[model samples]
Target: MSTENAAVNFSELVNRNKQTLARLKESPRLLLHRRDGEDLVLTTAARAEQDQTVVSAATRMLASLARREPGGMELLLGILPDVFPWVRFLPEPDLHAFTVELVDTMRAADSLGNSASVAQLLITWQHTAEVHSDPELLAALTRDHAEDYGPATNPRDVA
Candidate 1:
């Protein structure tokens, strides 16, 4: 979809459904902006399926390349910094581990036809890097804690 005309208020779908659908015909996807919560992407089933197909094929190819070639994983590692500069905050060993886990998770996600795990993995790693970025927080997290405060509360139990 063209970025210029790709986004429209979510109300367009509720009030001007037909016009919004027409816009989909011109561009394969639409970014629906919402004031209340997270924005959403609108696209035809065909387009979504096509995107999944591409992701699956590309991921499979990368997996295969990594297995067959000695430097394939290294090649991906070399580019990760450019694509995700936040990764620079991660320690060297963690960076390598992250790359390995990312590829494995991506392959599994593509096989399952769901990218949630991949997104979650990235978020988890990003949070890790964020912690490592802060010295006091990292030390607090890594330091020993022998005393038990209390039973941990479940997030769902909170109002």
Candidate 2:
């Protein structure tokens, strides 16, 4: 499916995903925007489950792409925008760890001599505009996914 970036109401978007998982696959690049003041509040359990689902699904998709072409690292830059509505909602350390791995992968891909990864790069900017606008979504993502984030691709000891 083609990537689309259109202005949308939060409520409408949620309703759009009511037939989720199956539907989410069809709109992998569909970015959502909220009409001002439309809040999407989730109970803690609901938030945790959704967070887990998003992380799992996004990670699986990214990993597959990475495996298909190592340049998939360039693709990771889109993770925040593509999988998530709010970048700020993402936990910093987890995101950071992921980013570190992404960069390493990108560098490895470069060594393998790729000219570029256009589709991967394109979806990134397409999704960036919608990030950082929703606190509720961010809270949910951070709370549930933080502890589960690692076994980092490269684990390290802190001083």
Candidate 3:
């Protein structure tokens, strides 16, 4: 075999692998690898969609509780990091707003087990700018001032 022919064959194999990876990225798909005697075949598989059963169950629980308690959205945010660790990096106020909007959407629609949508909602919310400025509003949100390092009383009297 000539070097040119070998290079062409290598490029073809690379293209085939790329196609397989692309296919595996959509939902869930698997290729069959077969081997008989000396014959061999390569296959690829990936779980593109994460298992949402547990997430849905949690969302259902939140929805049921929200139906009972008006502050269910707040409660969910209070513990959102337990499930979505990256969300902890987002500002608390943005998260609060995101949770409120998601709760509203979930309530408005007949969606009780759509945590994926809720997560997508958070992703959308994160793209926006932060606007937590009002002290009263921040306090009402159960969060302290962002830059309050002075003494509670007048610090002028301190040496």
Question: Each model's RMSD to truth, in Å?
Answer: 3.1, 17.4, 16.5
> Per-residue alpha-carbon lDDT of model 1 for 1-159, expressed as tens digits?
454447899998899999888898788788899999999989889988898888999999988877779899888888899988899999989999999899899998887888999999999999999999999999999999999899999999999
Error of 1 at 144 (Å): 2.1
Rank candidates, lDDT, best first. Answer: 1, 3, 2
lDDT of 3 by residue, 105-149 (tens): 655432543455655666665444222344555466666658877
lDDT of each: 0.89, 0.49, 0.53
Candidates 1 and 3, the one with greater lDDT: 1
Q: Rank the candidates by TM-score, best first.
A: 1, 3, 2
Per-prediction TM-score: 0.81, 0.23, 0.35
lDDT of 2 at 76: 60
Q: Which portions of model 3 show Cα errors greater than 4 Å?
A: 1-58, 106-119, 128-159
Candidate 1 residue pairs in backbone clash:
none
- State how far residue 159 of model 1 sits from its true place (Å): 13
lDDT of 2 by residue, 1-159 (tens): 533423345566567656433343444333344567544432235545665566555545666675567666456655655664444444556455555555445554444434254336434633442343456654565475435555655445653
Give me the overall lDDT of model 2.
Answer: 0.49
**Number of the top candidate by TM-score?**
1
Query: Which candidate comes out best when scored by lDDT?
Result: 1
